[model samples]
Target: MYVAVKGGEKAIDSAHDWMAEERRGDPDVAELSVPQIREQLSLAVNRVMAEGSLYDPDLAALAIKQARGDMIEAIFLIRAYRTTLPRFGASLPVETTEMACDRRISATFKDVPGGQVLGPTFDYTHRLLDFALEAEGLEAPEREAGEAAHPRMPRVTEFLNQEGLIQTEPRPDVDTAPRDLTREPLELPAGRPLRLQALSRGDEGFVLSMAYSTQRGYAKNHPFVGELRIGTVPVEVEIPELGFAVEVGEVVLTECETVNQFTGSKLEPAQFTRGYGLVFGQSERKAISMALVDRALRWKELGEDDKGAPAQDEEFVLYHCDNIQATGFLEHIKLPHYVDFQSELELVRRLRRETEGRVQQEAAE
Candidate 1:
C-alpha cells in the first residue's frame, strides 16, 4: 500500500533540498561570507542575537545567511542551536556607568555629566537613498577621531537620586538569586527581574506595540526618556579558586531609563518613578520600548490603579512576547489535517442527507 505519511516524508526532504538551492540565488553572484554579514549587516545580526536569547555574532550571522535574511527564521535557528550548547556559570551584572560610551543622550536633562555623544545614528539623516552605495568599492567618508580613553560616565538617574527626587530601585535585603525563565517555567505574578529578562529577549515588534499602546492612552503613565546609553561594558564572573571576580570579556549594550509618573500616600512623599531597559546591542528603539512596557507592567507594584490595558496585563504580555511561541502556534494550521477534516466532512454530509430526506417526506404529506 502507498502510505500517505511515507510519501509526505519524501516530499518534505525534497522541499528542503530545493530550498537549499534557492538560497544560493544566481550562480554568477559572489557568495556572501559569514564575516561580511557580521560586519556589514550588524543590525540584523543584533536583532537575531537579542530575540534568539543568544549573544554569538558569528552564529547569528550564519543563521541569517541560512534563513535568507528572514529575521524570525534566523532567530528560530539560533534558538534551536542554543538548546544543544553546554551551559556555563552565570556572569555578574555588568556595570553600565563604566561602559565605553558609543552613544549617550538624555531627553529630560539639557546636558548630562558625560555630555551627549551622538555616535553613529540614523536619527538626523535625510531619508533620501544614497545611490553611492550601489557603486562597487566605494570608500566610506572619514571623520576626525575623538579621545581614546573611556571615562566613567555617571548615570543621569544618579543626579535625581542624589536629591531623592526619584524612587530608588528595589533590592532584596538578602542577595537572592534572580529567576531564570529559560531554565525554569514562567510562573504568573512574576517579579521585575523575571519580567525584564523576558522583555530583553522578546520580539521587538511585540514589545514596541505594547509600548505604543501605553503612549496612545491605553495605560498612560506619562513617561519621559530619562536617559539612553549604548556602549561596550566589561563582563565579569566570580572565580571560586581566586575568591574574587575577574573580567571575562566585554559586550555591547543599550540601556534606557524612563522617568514615570509619581504616586504617593500619607505615609510617603511622591517621587518620580523609573523603568529600566537593557538589551544586547545598539537597539535604542527596542530599549526605549522595553522601558515603556516595563513601566506599564508595574501598575500594581507602583501602587497605581490597574488600567486594564493590554500592556498592563502581565500574563498577556509575557505569554505573547515570544515570537517563537507565537509563530509555532500560528503556523501549525498549515500542516496536514486529513483525518480531522475527513471526520468533519462526513458529519456535514450525513446531516445534509437527513435534512433532504425529511424535506421530501414533508412534501409528500
Candidate 2:
C-alpha cells in the first residue's frame, strides 16, 4: 500500500527549529551579543526605529539578527513588538526649538545665526570597500575632536522669516484635533500632520525612488534643501495632578526644509515657496525628500496651479505609500485562491471552444 504524506505539525516544528539555528549561524563561532548588534549595526537599528515607529536599540538589534539582516523583517519585528506593548499615554507635542542639535545645516544660507555643523556623515566618504573589514578589522579611527560648540542654533526658517520669504506655519493649540491615521481609515486630501505621519514610517527606498522621479523631469520640481537638522526633542507629558507639562523622555528627530522658487500670481508678488519634513532618526535624505514631496502636494493649499504632477496629487501621494501596507497588499495576491482559478478555467474553456470553431471554419475554406 502507498503511504500518504505525513508530518504536518512535526515538519512545521522542525522547520522552525532549523530557522532558529540558521539565524544564529555556525555553532563553532561565537554568538553575537545583543549589545554588540546594537552598537555595531546602528544604521539597521535606526532603520528599524524609523520604519517601525519604535525606539529600542537593543530590541531593534535582536530583530535585525533574527531577520538575518533583512531591514523590512526587522521593521516588522519592531512593529509586532510595539503592538504588544501597553500604551501609557500620549505625550505633549515636542518642542523642536529647544532641541540640543547634534548636526545642524542649511543649504539656503552661507552664514546663519548658528554656523553649519557637519557631524557624523558618510556623504564625503569614498564608496570603495575596505579589504581590512573582511576579517573584522580592529583599530578603527576614534571619534573626531569636537570643535567649539555653538550656544544656540536659530532655525534657518527664522532667517527666511526675517526676510518674510515663506508662509509661517501656525502652531497648533491644545484644542486642535489631530487626525489619527491609526484609529481612522486614511482619507483623501491629507493635512500636513497626517502626511508627516505616513512619511515618517514610510519605506525609505520607496520615498527615495519617488523623490528621484520628481528630479528627473517626471515632475518639474526644482527642490533645494533649505535646512536639515538631526537632534533630540524633549517629549513632555501633561501630568493631570500637577496641571503642567513635564519632560518624560526624548527622541531623535530629523527635520528638513525645502525652498522652491515660485514666480508669483496676480494677487501676490514672487515669493520663495517652502516644504517641511520631519521624521524619527537621522535620515537626511528621507527628510529632504519628504519636504520636497510635501511642498509638491501643497499646490492646492498654496493656491498654486495644479500642474497635475504625481507629487502634486494628494490621492496619489497619500494612498500609494507606506511599505508595510504596500507589501501586504502586494504579497496577499500570492495566497491560495481556488475560486479565482475556477473562474479563470471557465473563461479559458469558452475561449478554447470559440478558437476551435474558428480554426475548423478556416480549415474548411
Candidate 3:
C-alpha cells in the first residue's frame, strides 16, 4: 500500500517564491534593466532571436530577464510568444548582395572585392576577464565620428561559379511555398529548406558539437569558409492591394557560405559543393556550424556514401537538436513516481523470495 503524495501546488508555489527571490539577488544592488541587456548583452539577445525564430530584441531581452539568464528558457519563452502572434504576410526574400555589411571575411580569398572588414569580433581578443567592468561608473569608449560608406560587396561563391567549380542549388518551383516545421509535422526525407530551417533554430551547442565531430574526421568534407558576412538587410512584403512589394523593416543577419570538396561520381563530374547558413543576427558560430551540418546532411543528395556519422543522420540530428525538448524530458525525472516505484519494489522482493524458496527446496531434496 502506498499513500499518494500531496501539497504539490503549495510546494510549487514556494519553489517559485524562492526562485523569484534568488532571481532578484541583493535588493540593494541596482536591478539589470532590459535596455542594458538588449544593448550590452546583444550577442545573447541575438542568440535568443536566432533560436526562437523571432527578431524583436526588446521581447528577447524581456524573455531573458524572465528566464533569469537561461538562454534556452529565454528562447522557449520567445518561441511561445511568437506562436500567438497573427501572421500578416510572408516577406519577400531579402537580397544579401545588397546587405549593408558591418563584418565580412573569406578564408578562400584574402583580397575580395569589398575588402575584409573586421567589424566587432572576438576572434583576436584575449580570454581574460576585465575586472574594470566590475567597477561602478566606468565610462564607455568614445565613438569616432563620421561613418564610412559601405560599398556593395560581391559574394565569394560567385567568383567560383564563374569557373563552374561549385554545385548550384536547385531552383524551387515559384508556386510552391516552403513547408513550416512549426505548423506541420516533420516528415522523413526532408528537403534542404526544411533541414536548413530546423538547423537555423536548432540549439547552438548541439549544432556546434555536430560540426566539431565532422571536423575531427567523422565525415571530413574538406570544408572552407568561402564567406561569412554580418549586416542589416531590408525586409519587404508584397501587399495584394498594392501589387508591389514594400519595405516593411530591416533585420540584422549573419550569413555563412561553406565550400566543400566532393569526389566525382560515375554520373556527375568532380566539383566543389556549397553549404549555406543564414541566421537572425551576429551569430557566426551558430551560422558556421549550421552550414557545416547542412553540408553533412546533403551527403545523399550529393551522391556521397553515408559514413554513418551522427551529423549525416538527418533524423537523429534534427530530433535531438532541440534543447527545450531534451531538457523537459531530462528534468521530468524529478517528478514523483511513488506508485510505480512501489510496484517495482514489490516485484523485486517477490522474485527474491521465490529464488530463496527454490534453493531451500532443492537442498531438502
lDDT tens per residue, model 3, 45-118:
99999999899999999999989999999999998999999987789888999999999999999899999988
TM-score of each: 0.94, 0.90, 0.95
Model 1: residue 216 alpha-carbon error in angstroms = 0.4
Across 1-365, the per-residue lDDT of candidate 2 in tens digits comes to: 12323555567689999999898899899998889888887777887888888877788889988888888878888887887899878887776777778888887788877788787788788988988787864887776566535356877877777787776777776798777675577886677888877777788887776677778765566887887888888888888999999987788888888888777777756778888888777788788878877777777766677777787777777777677778778888897687999999999999999999999999999
Mark the 10 consecutive residues where model 1 has the least summed lDDT.
143-152
Model 1, position 247, has a per-residue lDDT of 96
Better of 2 and 3 by TM-score: 3
> Per TM-score, what order, best first?
3, 1, 2
Error of 1 at 81 (Å): 1.1
lDDT of 1: 0.90
Q: Evaluate model 1: give its TM-score.
A: 0.94
Displacement of residue 196 (Cα, Å) in model 1 is 0.6
Give candidates' CA RMSD values in order: 1.9, 2.8, 2.1
Off by over 4 Å in 1: 1-3, 172-174, 351-365
Ranking by lDDT: 3, 1, 2
What ranges in model 3 sit over 4 Å off? 1-6, 142-148
